[model samples]
Target: MDDGSGIAPPHIEGYEILEELGQGGMAEVYLAEQKGFGRTVALKVVRLSKYTQVDQKELCLRFEREAKIVGKFHHPNIVTVYDVGTMGNFLYMSMELLKGGELTTKIKSGRVSALEACNIVRSMCEALSAVHAKKLIHRDIKPHNILFRDDATPVLTDFGIARSVMNSGDATGLEDIPDLTEVSMIIGSKRYMSPEQSIAAPLDYRSDIFSLGVVFQEMLTGERPVNFHDPASVSNPSNNTVAWPQEALIFKPLVTKMVEMNKENRYQSIDDVIEAMDTLDNKFVNESAPLRISRIYLFIPLLFLISVAIWILSPFTTNYELTALDPNNRLIDKSSLSIYLVEGLEKIRSFKSLPVGEHKIALKVSGYRTKVIAIDFPLERNTTINLTPVSSPSVEEFYTFQDLLEKGPANSASAKEFTERYGGSVLSDLVDIWSGENAVLLNELSVAAKLNDPSAQLALSELYDRGWYVPKNSDLAQNLSKAAAEQGYAFAQFQYALILMSQMKYTKDEEEFIRLLEQAAEQDFFLAELLLGMIYANREYRSYDPEQAHRYLRRAANKGDRVALYELAQMIEEENPEEAKIYRERAIRLGFKVNQDF
Candidate 1:
């Protein structure tokens, strides 16, 4: 049968080829129908052009070996291998066909949302865990090998490149293959290959984890952490020269650790990485819930006292803070004190109301000078200042978060100059601004926020809430989020309402939670609006008002919320045929399944 590519496709036993899918380095996959069952299946024909008679026999054995390895793993997240056979001179395998495109396509299109990325990563982890349990390592775990089902469920495919941990013989034969027409010595894609795998060293499950980390990074950032060379010359570059990019594209800490170069330093097991991802995900979700800072702040003093006592008893102690400001700053609040000093320099010391302070601060980078100041002061009254290095060495300056907090509506000369140089987009200028001096950026944000700069308020609020450079303070997070929310930042409003909801749940502050959600929904944060709809739709949370829930949910669904579509479809299944038709049609169009039962 002629495939779509107009090539005469190879005929395999028991399967009738209707069309050609595509060809990879060693295999050509075809869209075929199983004769008796009439089920559409993906048939992959593995070419043996480079294999000698002896090598062909060994290749056939290894192909069967891979088929057995993958067939044993039956997971919803993993692609199911149906049968393995040889037709004439070609070795072939058949598997379930996934109608949806690869994960790479979705990532390239920028259609995979953050939440969707998390879900895909989590599912892949589960699949990896299962495969690893059976002692099979999927040496290749790039985006192309990850297939999505019709419902957008990710299924990891192509275990043909998988290595069997139980058998060491497969490794030797693979090494013996001539390089002329063979796959490179590196068994996997260069960009996603682990350090050990790149060098052809003996690999374990950690190798798979490393590849998964690269996939996770690609899913989050829409770019590969390590640039890959062309497939033919992939082995030419020295592995030591390739370093994983340190840019905070994803901003999640756990996934960063998984991609570490040293195998010993990487996640010990797939379970460990999954646990960390889950913890981080839960923390993020919980942070979105409503929260009350007043009661939480009550415990800070007690914790501070205990920390100070421990610090005083420790043998090594070094503490210091910036005590003065240059260029006659008028941004200082009347109640704010500038005389920051370190108490008990010879003993243990702690910074009160600070996020995780360290001792013996030093500036060793080029073009930066280090200055140290010593001071003696009462423990109760002293302000501990942290000096940040400025980009321009000539302009000596000292600014604190408090200065930024109180700065009036007027951009600093430095802020304006930096903004002009780096472009006004907050995300664009973030790196340069952050690298120079975070305190200055914070101060600039304060000025902009006071001046009613919506962008600045949103950026500053996110930095505070996520503890981007500074220590995390939930109180400060809430305050900043509220400030941005007031400026009609949709994301900030959603976050503020979430925090408020969490606080209400913890402290029984129902009134505050309701008020925040109403404000957030009014500003058109569809997620917040969706939550409100759920609250009204469910009898357990609030009164069951279908009309009220439908109004809000339909609005959000119209704006393209997949969850809202599902919920709206559920709500109007039998109640309103006309409205249900609108929602269900929209839901299907938006890539959400109307009935999940299938």
Candidate 2:
């Protein structure tokens, strides 16, 4: 639907439209050049279709109000609002035009790399943080509202739909209406709507987090978590099933929390989400190391004593017992026995009860050379047995694994130094790992995890469940995450719930996921709480009840999750507009921002 002339609505003020950028149900955005500045900008003009003079006046006022709200924000991540005016019957707002396309388009094209996606999200979080700090809630957040420049930096646009904390004088009257003919009962894009928003409840910043979670999922998986043909379908329980495609690369835990149905179970604030991302990054870099040393040191002596006791308890010369030992000449930990068995096997002779007269045992570990030991056991009495592993290579020759352990303090110090020198680069790198190459970065991760690195374990578990770089191994991921969770890693516990939810192949086990999510939420893993909220909000997942979701979401919103604020506002307002108005007021004070189309 284009003409070569590219002229739209004649001429608006002194500016001329060269081409139509796009059109929505309510308005048309144009690619235009300013008359005096010759600078190109996006010109948004209201459609006057089927409107009376009264409606026109109301619409004009709303459009002007949007400009006023957006123009006040001057952050780098926010799109610049240039001018606002009316040309005859057509009212318009002029704003900065980003050359890049919408985030949705980029995701659809499958060109958004994991790192790039994380970077975009980081910028968005920064912007949202700023908006929240200023006490504004973006009522609507969707891919179309985000403009990505050539550098891949995202500029949040469209403040027309933004709910502001600052008083707008009479303009508040227009926003105060219970329902406007132009106001679709559905407030946000169906695929990205928070539970409260889908129900026409009042909303705040938490609503934005819900939408961002959807956006993050789409960026990582190349598809939206929820797909619907119409806005009404968003609230349909039958359409709520979540399935990550086989081809998709997921950080399971992150996706799980992001898509939590409840606002409280999600990240309490953008900062929390950012912190989770940071933890994931550290996990990807080193999986097990210093922790490995600690585990070996703690259990080595115990394992050796147990093996000796088993040997002593044997009754006859017909019995034989075999045990493996590490390079340190200590018995291998029970947890790691499987790996030891797989790696070292010389021969399998007949097995007896125990206390064999004589036996030969061979042992091998990754870094050490093989060693064989000859043992003789007394048939009638307890005897002692000992075997020493040969040191095949010097510490420097085969020390990549050891180097990972050594690199811990170095990397930490380096990161600190880099951060001090280059500001956010070190943190940015960490975010990249958490959000990007988590699965494939296993060796590095194993070193960190073995060292009981909380951050590394969290990232590894997230990658495993999400199938980021490895096969989707929810069981293994859950096990690792459980270990980390037990260690008091909040990020790990939050992600653990996500893995549990995904593996809920049985019906009765749903409560287990809820319990884990609740635990994580208590630790301030806001995303887990938000998921709990969503679960309670929906009748299908509301076995625990909606009140629970509300309670948790309110907690997160209070912590400054913009998306939660919007959701809570919407929920309260549906039943009690006055109460909803108070929540909305709070959302404004908290500073939530979103694209506006009036």
Candidate 3:
């Protein structure tokens, strides 16, 4: 059925293919010799024979998308994208050749020094900062994706599943796949997938941080924390086991949080990860001063005098005025907070005396998240620390979670993903109500809505519309819907647009209402698409286009909306009676009852 020998072409775009390096699912890597400079390069190519004509075009578009993304990045630690084009039948890309090979090889040989590993991780943080600043997520970040040069500098590569956060581009040819549901499926190296990514959850920069944690863990222990790479194992938090030697104890906490089951619980950004790294190692720094020999001697005498003075005056003088801050920067009461002198030290809320030097302190509050912060005495600087509420998720996090639920991962398989990630939260009861797992109390639902949960927002909005929970207020419903919509929740957008459309007699912004409806439709909201198509069938709100209406109705029908199918049948009845009859029959099968009355 297959030939054993490789079909290595002689040359591509004047670059001679010297030898086969290896093969992957989508493409093959080759050691190539460039014609002009005679420089060696790694050329990745997708052979034409491996795919059909239609598939070749689709795969090439995907390959080109990867090229377009990586082309924008220029960093010493990032693989350099040379030229991207097609030669004969193969879509290929030339990248800077690395002679040292993959990071996986070095990791397998032996454990790297902790300092070396931290430095490598710092480089990754810097690279991720660049990527995130560009509003992109490197969905595939693993030891295998990291390559090394002669100098042992790590270079990040393979942008096959990287997604742009801007959401401002044409499809990555993924829609052209025969089974479109596969698009929502996990698309990365399983061993290094973030928990959010494991469930097909929408990702941000934090996802890359999680993946980097897996790689960093392996770098120190010579194996992954969770070795069996599968959708289930990767998603399960209990499977993660830190096998750290005594030397790596200092880094255990940071690594453990990096691979947190919840994105909100993880370090919020690349800067946060860098901060944790510097916290784990005093040697990692961004603050320093030049000390000459003369200054060193002068400073020693000055320190002796200051220490003598501090010894005598320290009893009466204040060492530092420490103030705890909530995540919002509001001054938290000292009574509710417990401040520890150092890591693993006893907790003390109020301190009478402290040393006149750098100190590390951990802040733990009853209902707030805990963190260790490095502080300097006599430092009254307004440095901020993030605090996550123990009882309820914040407005931003609540809305982000809603965005994840609405569009993050929605396939049937994703639905069966371990629920404990979201189920263990304080709002677990509220979530259970939404999933029909359990009922939530009315007061609890109201509290969740007030705390910014999107489902609670929708429920409260509906109640407001019918005078159920609190009061009947259409205006309040409109506001709640708009708030959720702005957070990129498709359901809220659709509801907000509908509420406004019905209240057009009381409201005047027809254009805004149409725009809101279209935004929801763009997200492939079936109901929104159907309503938009119906609205566009007439010039009731704005200039109407029959063609546009047909296009949207078609999209809704593709998603198996019976109302859209029935409407489409009506629209084509005069032009194509036979097709209309078939559409009508299908709509009826889907329980669409035809009615003459509006």
Candidate of highest lDDT? 3
TM-score of 2: 0.43
Q: What is the TM-score of each candidate against the true structure?
A: 0.42, 0.43, 0.45
Tens-place lDDT per residue, model 1, 1-598, is 3232324677777899898898887678899987745668999886665457887877787677677767665455788676798876678898889999898888788735555666678778878888877666788898899998776668898876676553434432334332222223567788789877887777878888888888887766665554433443334434423232333233356666777777899898887877777665644433422242334645668777565445443332224243422224322231122121122111111232222343332111111112223333223233333322212101001112212223422436544454454343443234334444466556555544433344555566656665666666666666566655654455556667777766655434555555666776776667667777876798765446778898988877777776687788789888787877777777666555444320
Instruction: Report the poorest 10 consecutive residues by lDDT, candidate 1.
Output: 392-401
- Per-residue lDDT of candidate 3, residues 26-139 (tens digit): 788999977744668999987777687888777877777777777766454678776788776677899889887887887888998766787678778867877787777888
lDDT of 2 by residue, 294-329 (tens): 455555678665554454444542333456654356
lDDT of 1 at 362: 18
Report every candidate's CA lDDT: 0.60, 0.58, 0.66
- Candidate 3 ranges beyond 4 A from true positions: 1-5, 166-183, 226-241, 283-598
Report how far off residue 59 is in candidate 1 (Å): 3.2
Clashes of each: 13, 75, 0
Give candidate 1 misplaced runs (Cα > 4 Å): 1-7, 47-55, 166-185, 226-251, 288-598
The worst-scoring run of ten residues by lDDT in candidate 3 lies at 283-292
Clashing pairs in 3: none
